[model samples]
Target: MNEVLVSEKLVVRVPCAVIEYNGKVLAGQRSAALSFPLKWEFPGGKAEKNESDEDALYREIKEELDVDIEIIQKLPVTSKDQGWREIILVPFICRLKTLQITLTEHEQILWLGPEELSSLDWTEADLNVIENYYEYLSVKK
Candidate 1:
């Protein structure tokens, strides 16, 4: 017989930003070296030690895309159970201060509308965020 273990863990607050321009949201394709490589996700990263969520968002956007963002709204937390590692993502609705995006951590990037989101192969963590955003948009309309 094989023994199995199950553990419950507290959720982490990882800040994410939804950058939209001309009615399309920005999504980056993770590098092949990453765990979920080639998957599309919003341009943001984990909150640094001793950094506020807002500060983390600003730094992440600037480092990853080389663009400044003005946070418009603090969106809800997007959670996902990844079996091994769980995640709690805080997504913010933001506007880009510049049009150019320089990919530093990602392999490629896409600016997609709501319809395009469903078609892309997103990471499990990102899929939850996408679904929640879709529901949010539906409710707003």
Candidate 2:
């Protein structure tokens, strides 16, 4: 007989920004020093304990991109399970307060239209979020 142990997943809340400027969405390429390096993702970070999603996003955008953002509305949520953890991703539609972006944790950034969103290899969760955004657009249009 073999003994098996089961454990519950550790869920982490991550606040994400789907920032639009001049008809393009902001995407960041992960830094080489980070997990999933070089994969493109919307700018955001994990929420601290007791932090609201919006506040986490605001602080993350400021800290990571060196730009302030005004969140417009909530977008779709995406969830995924990694071997070590489970992620709950909440994305918000946002507008940039400044035109300039200074990245601290990303190698580079791109401004792309919906049609061009697939040009880069995105993180698994982000790819799902993009699909939801596309569906939202198709329904809206």
Candidate 3:
């Protein structure tokens, strides 16, 4: 069984990046050592106390992918319960500022199109993020 890191806190805040480049969104596969082993998700991590979601996203993308991103807009927030902890995912639509990516945390990464996003085995919160993002895109058009 996958070990879930139960948090003593009431709610955990996670900021995620929905990095877009050339009409594709970046998705990362969680490392096998992580809680959601091999599940696909946007690259980001838990927000520290007093840190904004945008700041956390910038820090996380740099730490995980070794690339800089420009936040374009904020997507709808998604929440999920792992039975051990509650997580609120703050997703942002971002533009990739650099081309070179060095993966430090994820097992692998992929640039997926709108139609392709739902084809992967994504985390539950990410599924919500994807849905919300697609709706956001549709409204923008």
Candidate 4:
């Protein structure tokens, strides 16, 4: 007989910004130093214990991009299971407080139309976020 061990996976909550400017959305490419290097994702980070999602997003965007943003609305949440852990991405539609950006962690960033978003290699969770955002846009129009 074989023995099997099962345990609950860790869950991390991340608040992400879907920043838009002039009808284009912003995405950042993960630097080689990050876990998912080279994959594109929205700008944000994991929420620290006891921190609210909005506060976490503000702090993360400031730290990562060195810019401020006005969060407009919240989109449907997306999640992914990576075997070792599960990530729940809480996406917020936002606009930059300023046009200038200074990257701290990402290799680079791109501003792209919605149709062009699919061209980039996105993290699995972010793909779902894109789909939800698209649906929200379609319904809004």
TM-score of each: 0.86, 0.92, 0.92, 0.94
lDDT winner between 3 and 4, please give it. 4
Ranking by TM-score: 4, 3, 2, 1
Candidate 3 lDDT for residue 32: 100
- Which pairs of residues clash in candidate 1, taking residues 3 or more apart in a chain or in different chains? none
Q: Compare the candidates by TM-score and give the number of the best one.
A: 4
Instruction: Return the TM-score for candidate 2, rounded to 2 decimals.
Output: 0.92
What does candidate 3's lDDT look like per residue over 1-141, in tens digits? 899986585799999999899889889999999999999999999998999999999999999999999999999899999776889999999998998999999999999898899999999999999999989989999
By summed lDDT, the worst window of 10 consecutive residues in model 2 runs over 131-140
**For model 2, which pairs clash?**
none
| Model 4 worst lDDT run, 10 consecutive residues | 2-11
- Index of the highest-lDDT prediction: 4
lDDT preference between candidates 2 and 4, better one: 4
Q: Give, for candidate 1, the lowest lDDT window spanning 10 residues.
A: 5-14
Counted clashes in each candidate structure: 0, 0, 0, 0
Write down the lDDT of every candidate, Cα atoms only.
0.84, 0.91, 0.93, 0.96
Q: Judge candidate 2 against the unseen true structure and give its global Cα lDDT, from 0 to 1.
A: 0.91
